[model samples]
Target: MTRSIYSFFICIIFLTAYSCKDNPKHTDDIAESPEQQLKQRYSKLVTYPLDSTAFPRSVNLKTNNLKKVPSKDWTSGFFAGNLWQIYELTGDTAYKNKAKKWTAFIEKEKFNDRTHDMGFKVFNSFGKGLKIEDDQEYKDNILMSAKTLITRYNDTVGSIRSWDFNKKRWKFPVIIDNMMNLELLFEATKISGDSIFHNIAVKHANTTLKNHFRPNNSTWHVLDYDPENGDIRMRVTHQGINDDSSWARGQAWGIYGFTMAYRYTKDQRYLDQAKATAAFFLDHPHLPEDGIPYWDFDAPNIPDEPRDVSAGAIVASALTELYAYTDNEYYLNYSKKVIHTIKSSDYILDKDIEYPFILDHSSGDWSKRSEMDEPIVYGDYYFLETLLRLKDLK
Candidate 1:
């Protein structure tokens, strides 16, 4: 009886393996023509309303009195950006109107007082929204936000100041994350016909290109400068395992930002930088077999360190853009690979058919005080945006 049972189990195992081998939906088959599959998936995903609220408005902001926190700003702006992308893809008035409302909310926050993230919170929320809708009010608000951002740019340091409270102590303030924010300045230049914003944006980009990016294309999160003389004082990472360690999100920001810079300036150096950074990010040993990146590339030392789906989603979205810019099949293929990996991985929350949250194990910040290892609003937004970009790409 024991021998018969063992043989039966072996037969079942063999059948299962055979079935999997013959499965038409195997990873390689699905990924072979990823762009086509991505478009199909995107059509299905975007047909459903993720949130039925007012335009530009977010369901994520239902939390109470979350004052004095950058997370609130980041989340709300990120949502607005995603909504704008949705409107662009669907051409649905509902998404466009929601984007308007959210941009108004961000405008009401008074851009003048904002610090480091004014570009992100305003550009993504207001500028990008207005670009889609062509609302004059939104355009005006974006200009105001640009002026606010310009104030943060320190002429002496040749870069933007990240935090004012650390004002007198540190200068030459540049962070890998700030690369994402520079879009505000670039957009302002186009909208307002002001070269000042462009100059500052280029200066910040040049400083980062010269200082923060490492030889291997991995980047330091923060590079402190001597306020007095604008000399490089230290290379540090605010959210990584150590100063020398590579942060996955930071690398994603670099890839996206440098590619964006290339798009704006048509500069080969920016493209080269973006490609190098992309290589380091995709080639990291710590990257999961599924193609999702951990919260930090060096996070293996920390037990149970969460992965950042936000980083992976942003990188995938940027990779799509990179593909469009370069028409490189490899970039397009990589973007699809990452998206498919996320979709198939256990991290994706598709159980809630009504509101599917794409990807999991996303960390706002594991080492610091954040919603560490939770499904972040931005992660979901970027994932959806990536799907839309895939759908629209020719």
Candidate 2:
């Protein structure tokens, strides 16, 4: 009888050990919500021993290693923003402390005028931090960053310059992704009562609305403008399949940027443009059934192409906001469907992986063969945003 009791105790110990691997906070082991699964995943990720000098960016699959970036990298703020969003969702002070630590490293980007990514770098980090708790430093830094961002805008071009390089091939290069940066300007105007920032944002958005999109509301990756006469010198692509193809992430940016424009201004044109671009994305022939899109909508290999999980995350987050404004069930349902698809084990990284990213298979720039089919920082950033938006929407 003693021997039987000992065997039973051993069995119980084995079962308890197995359950602990999934964490003590597991709600439903087999059927957890995406938010719960992501929470569990981040609980493990928050414990990784990372150095403060560099920020986590992506996993290089060839080396199977974590890729870290300095503050100057465009993706520098996403990891911190993800931590902030995580703290917002879980109410975990540990995550908040981590978020602040990482966010401090991005403040130097406030004066970084060389790149047009101030909104992406400083706004995402300090901007998100301010949302959790009001801080004068964050507010000041955000306003300064907005001041730095407008230095790239040209009144003649009616848009913000996207890149300074390739100057020989292009005169004044602007991109659809630049539309996403206008949020900083709008916010800065509201906080500082500066019309200079607001006017520049409106001009850039109007120029992008006029020139960046095709007849079908699909956006080009880049547009070259004559800096002197404001004429469109050339239409091209730096990241899409080609000059004529619609890049997945660029379209995602268009819908998001325009929707945000409508939110602040209540302009009917911006709302109409947002809806049109959104329909272009949702009704596209090449978009996958799961709502994730290929790197380019016109990529030759349809069923065999790599998917951009980041684009789907951005779209899901944008749709939640769109639904909030329009009260549209289609937008909400699509957002929920994307969350359901990507939260599965097939997309979420395994619990055993040491890399800090949450989702896998985000294609960054396939034309450059960069960050292909790998975990990216922005994918996790927008994934967290989508979760927060969906939770609030519900």
Candidate 3:
């Protein structure tokens, strides 16, 4: 019996040793300092295919598969912008070199007037370049891109056309996403002292504010306008779950865009609009406790739904600006919560992996079954933007 007792005690001691190894109790293991985490995250991006033809969109985390897109794609500028932000954050010359190289490729987009994402493309690339380096050529390219973008604006429609793909099904479709493009136009007015560009941006914002928002201040993704009378024809959702649901990214765009408008124009109406839209997002019962939002707030599946880190990043960045404007602690504290949550293990990519991306699990066009639960370039771009903004606040 004494021999049996000794063996049992020995087995218990071995099991206890294994459990201690399995679960580390060190504070360092549980939490990482923000600056240390940021450096570790960006250090891996140095060798992320920084060549001319490489614009990474989404990456398959498990398989280490990257989706490279061409320069003409709307998402092309985001990766370049990400590099610029990294340089700004870390003061690394290698990232600056990569940023200059990648931003040059997007110069060809200044003449491509076929799409409404000129702001997303040119502003993110050249706009950031102008801010960082103040290159005259970058400023000139941004102005030229804004001129090309305004060509798509129809006087009768009072908004720029979003997509030409579903022409048979819709006429003059203007999406809430177009609100994002107004920043380029507004910046154009400041750079060139041209009121024409400013006027166009205001008209588009007012038109969207009047028609795009539902009764609850949740924006519809797409709105079809009568090209003849500038009247609302229909409200629809292209990338959302359904026509009636609030798409997470679309709502985020509305909040961010209007907040930016308030910044430039200092219009009380725009500020009020941003606050109302933010309320709709923050007060929504479905928003996850982690502060990362699902692809759609109203997606039928609650806990099982895919989260869009891009939307979370955008909202967090915008909220920081909103806090600055209104001196609202709620916005400031909430924004910090979002940034911290994203820095957690579940959303941040592993340090040792050569993951060509930063944040993970961003849903892109979920309805189309494309880029679901992947790390998209835009997600990384906005995540960097949010971090820089938070650092500035510090």
- Runs of candidate 2 exceeding 4 Å displacement: 1-39, 49-52
lDDT for model 1 = 0.68
State model 2's lDDT: 0.83
| Tens digit per residue, CA lDDT, model 1, 1-394 | 1222222322232342222222343344344233233333334234443332322211222342222323235555766676677666546666566666555667754355556677677777776676676778777877787787888777778888776546565555578888877888888889889999888989988888999888898999988988678888888877787888898888988999998888788889889999899889877777876677778888765436777778888898899899887887767777666665664456564444323233456777645656556656677777767766676663
- Using alpha carbons, what is the TM-score of model 1? 0.79
What digit string (tens of lDDT, one per residue) describes model 3 on residues 128-154? 888888688988998999899999999
| Each model's total of backbone clashes | 6, 0, 0
Compared with the true structure, all predictions reach lDDT values of 0.68, 0.83, 0.82
- Give me the runs in candidate 1 sitting further than 4 Å from their true place: 1-72, 166-172, 301-304, 351-359
- lDDT winner: 2
**Model 1 residue 290 distance off true place after TM-score fit, in angstroms:** 1.4
Q: Model 2, 1-394: lDDT tens per residue?
A: 1222222322232342222222323333425443444456687557755556678888986798777889988898888898999988767788888888888988888988899988898889988999998999999999999989988989988899998888889999998888888888999998899899999999999999888889998999999999999999899999998999988999999999999988888888999999999999999888888988998899898889999999999998998899988988888778866766764336877667768878888998866788988999999999889877766653
Q: What is the TM-score of each candidate against the true structure?
A: 0.79, 0.90, 0.90
Total backbone clashes of model 1? 6
